[model samples]
Target: MIIKKTSLVTETKDNMRGGNGAPVITHVIGGEILGNKGRLYSKIVMQPGDSIGYHQHVGEQEIYYFLSGEGMVKDNEETIKIYPGDVMITPDHGYHSIENTGTEELVFMALILNADA
Candidate 1:
């Protein structure tokens, strides 16, 4: 099966997770597409000053894979810089957030998977 670009869905959410600015999310493969095993499989774009505020995963794990641009991630209350080819993961019971600190836009891929009990 093939999913074309035109068929994909995109949305822009303001103050996402108590963030400073809005970030665009382009859904590549939605949860329903994967039978709910995953919560998110999408491309995330954040303009300068944009961010995804700190949040916790109660029963899941989240991964962020940077494609281009630069940003900072809040991992376990620590701030870490991120760049292209960088991968960060927040396991179950973990907390994290991300902000685009570069002058240009920051693009990355995000994946959220359910944690086994």
Candidate 2:
């Protein structure tokens, strides 16, 4: 299916689980609310000193791609710096979290699956 800009959609606030978020979430596309199958995903835009909470999955693989700005990722084992166009993957047994480490906004995409994850 194709997404059309002229079509009206819904808007919602994202009550972030941690320190100072952008204060909202827009469902550009995904499941449950958008009828996607099995995958629960979203686009999150964060800024310096803002972040998402630390969490993990039991049986899923997750990835965070740095679209812009700079950040760091801790995977329960080590912490590493993230730069533009960088990617970090978290396996099922590892714990991971990302933080903005730049002077500008950090943009990225988060993907999580509901099944066995």
For model 1 the TM-score comes to: 0.95
| Residue-wise C-alpha lDDT for candidate 1, range 1-117, written one tens digit per residue | 989999999999999999989899999986787665877899999999999999999888998999999999999989999999999999999999999999999999998888861
* Candidate 2 lDDT tens digits, 28-99: 556654343335455567768776667766666666767788887777868899898888877776677777
Question: What's the lDDT for all of these models?
Answer: 0.92, 0.65
RMSD of each: 1.2, 3.4
lDDT of residue 70 for candidate 2? 88
Best by TM-score: 1
In model 1, the Cα lDDT at residue 95 comes to 99
TM-score of each: 0.95, 0.73
What stretches of model 2 exceed 4 Å from their correct place? 5-15, 19-24, 32-37, 114-117
Superposed on all Cα atoms, model 2 deviates from the true structure by an RMSD in Å of: 3.4
Model 2: lowest-lDDT 10 consecutive positions: 6-15
